[model samples]
Target: MLMIFGTWASQVMSRTLHEASIAEKYEQWMAQYGRTYEDNAEKERRFMIFKDNLEFIENFNNAGNQSHKLGINKFADLTMEEFKATHTGYKSTQPKSSKTVSPFRYNDTEDVPSSLNWIDEGAVTDVKDQRQCGKGITILSFVSSYY
Candidate 1:
């Protein structure tokens, strides 16, 4: 009975350590990619959701008889409904143009001009942090227009 209790305790400790290591790795990845949350509670919630989705995707990918391809991406914190609503909302509201015009064609083989500095030409912009209010779209649009 003592040996059994010792083995169980060891297993529990090992699992706890493994989970801690996984959480550490996740935090590191988030920091490297400049991800942040409003507060500790939000961060913990998102991390839990990310872990569950990652495990599900890994299992699906490893299944022998699976036909559909399953992969993990940065949007694991978002649910399917939220993702669809955000991305697909524009599709239904697209305005139709009555004029039929020839599409402009570009020559892919042509080299870019040697004197072109993309940064100066307004191709790149500075990053701005939008805290709490979720006004990222408005900020980005204003910045792009100003540049």
Candidate 2:
């Protein structure tokens, strides 16, 4: 019947429009991050990850109570495991030594402040952002704190 055909056509049209919108969004995200893929398969895989990350970001931002918000960055296309494995720096290949347990030394629990702020007391350094590679901010901060 004509009515059935119209309903099916409208559904198909809506799906097509949705797909187009998603593709456009992904394209814009890729452009913003200067991303590219070697092939369609890889692109599709990364696109799915990007979509999931976007959804997470949106949900976090939509929450009523939050101190900060998240945005799409250069690492948006990576899965959580893949991101941790790649960005977590070097891994040791050495064999493990025998474990040893030590008894507790500090027995006094009184006269201690509820909170500590080493940064405000000039005992520790402040937090810094490392957007790029090979700047050596962490160890340098520790050394400067002592020096």
Candidate 3:
């Protein structure tokens, strides 16, 4: 779970950082004064730092606790949340027959409703999709206090 969290968190953060860097550069390029050599140089420097930070994050996944100094604990926490949303208790699928209740599958048959309704019922957000927000997984994780 930790490994999965680390990988996903790194991917999300990397993408976010890339987007932010691009936006920042675009904003600078569109300044009213127009672009200057020094402005370009400064932008490049900022981009380099962004790139290095992303690389550091990627390397941190394998660096054990070295990333903690860089405030990666929050990233790790986010990764764990993403992992829980997509995985955790996902191995078992709901059974087709009424006799067996599949703990894994959200919706088994017509009789039982899926806990997935929680996501659907709540206000949708950019952060998560309805199917990805598995209520059962959240419950188990919460009770177990894993994260």
Candidate 4:
């Protein structure tokens, strides 16, 4: 009985160490290539969920005959109910217009520029880190309007 308990304890410790190693690797990868979130309880909770999802995705892909390069670029930390409440309450009240406009016509196709580099023209704004605030759409709209 004592030997059996010792074996079980060793197995548990090995599993715990393996999990810690994976978590450490994930942290290093995040620091190198991913966006950093604030170090808080909420962020920690989201990180754990994200890690579990990533592992599940990796296992599923490996189990299949065909290799699918699946990955998680961002984590949706909010619960489904919370997400629905935040995003579904607002309804647009604007009435639709019945007016039609003629399509734009250009006379000289040769005069049209083939490509544009907004960054080279100094029209693009620097990337902003709006961590956990969810103001990406607003920022993008403001930047696009500048052009």
Candidate 5:
């Protein structure tokens, strides 16, 4: 009867240790998963806000002069400050203009790579009279040439 009691006691002790090891492992995994989830959520939020601000800037840039007269600079400065505060790791990834050309030459030079064969420069049959030249023409040329 003493031997039987010892055997039962040993089994119960082993089972308790086994359960504790499993619980510890489970807790460790949960902590790791929680950190990963939080990191991903933070990245997603930053990207979303960045995208929204970029779209607003693009639309504002495309607007006419009268629309441009609005207090966009003040708003943009405030928004940028807020964005930088929230997303501390954020940095502008935009590359500087590689073309060593002035605005006058940039629009005039047409010798783009042949690999971009999809750009149909002559296909633009119609544009408003005011857009026939200047910045719109430059933008159109760039878009058409890159295609």
Candidate 6:
């Protein structure tokens, strides 16, 4: 009976210490990402998302079978829906048109290369760092015509 009690007490203490360490990690992540909430409720909500994301990151990395791995970033505190809605703006409501378009450039499959290196072609823009500003990836599309 004494051994049983001792085991239970040790288990409880271990769990408490593990939880404390997790909470400390959350605090450090929040500080790094400059995350803040208006109230305790909001903080708790974000913390749940953050914890879920951390678990996913860990599991993905531990698998060790993939060419790439996931990591916690500035968007770690957000849910998938929240991140998409906020960062990936302009979801088209219109139905897809059954349109066939002809390519202006790279028209000939035989002439075209298998893959493109836009950087080598000097078509790519300079890399932008949004450190502390915390901006999401944005793509711009433009249609050109001779005026």
Total backbone collisions for each predicted model: 0, 0, 1, 0, 0, 0
Tens digits of per-residue lDDT for model 3 on 59-145?
Answer: 776677663545322122123344444555343354556686548664445654333433354543334345754345432211111
lDDT of each: 0.70, 0.80, 0.50, 0.64, 0.52, 0.79
- Candidate 2 similarity to native, TM-score: 0.53
| Local lDDT at 26 for model 6 | 91
Structural similarity to truth (TM-score) of each candidate: 0.52, 0.53, 0.22, 0.44, 0.24, 0.59
Per residue, candidate 6 scores C-alpha lDDT tens digits across 1-147 of: 999999999999999997788788899999998888999999988888888888899999999999999988889998987887676664655666889766766454465555665656678754556464454655444332322
The candidate scoring highest on TM-score is: 6
Q: How many clashes in candidate 3? A: 1
The parts of candidate 2 lying over 4 Å away from their true place are 1-18, 90-147
Candidate 1 error regions (>4 Å):
67-69, 90-147
Q: How are the candidates ranked when ordered by lDDT, highest leading?
A: 2, 6, 1, 4, 5, 3
Clashes of 1: 0
lDDT by residue (tens digit), candidate 1, 1-147: 999999999999999998897698678768766789999999998888878877788788888688787765566776666676675443544466977876657535465554644456788755567563343455443322211
Off by over 4 Å in 3: 32-147
Pairs clashing within candidate 3: 94-105
Tens digit per residue, CA lDDT, model 4, 1-147: 999999999999999998888677667656666646677776687667666767776787888876566665444344445455566454445664778866656544565455665655688756677565454445442323221
Cα lDDT of candidate 3 equals 0.50
Query: Best candidate per lDDT, number?
Result: 2
| Cα lDDT of model 5 by residue, 1-147, tens digit | 999999999999999996566445434544554423257666455445434554576676667654453222212223575755554446666776788755665665677674443345464544446542324343333334442
Where does candidate 5 clash, by residue pair? none
Worst 10 residues of 2 by lDDT: 138-147
lDDT of 2 by residue, 1-147 (tens): 999999999999999998788788899989998899999999999999988988899899999599999988888899987776687664556665878766766655676666666777788777666665534545334322211
Candidate that beats the other on lDDT, 1 or 6, i.e. the better one: 6
lDDT of 2: 0.80
Model 4 spans with C-alpha error above 4 angstroms: 72-147
TM-score of 4: 0.44
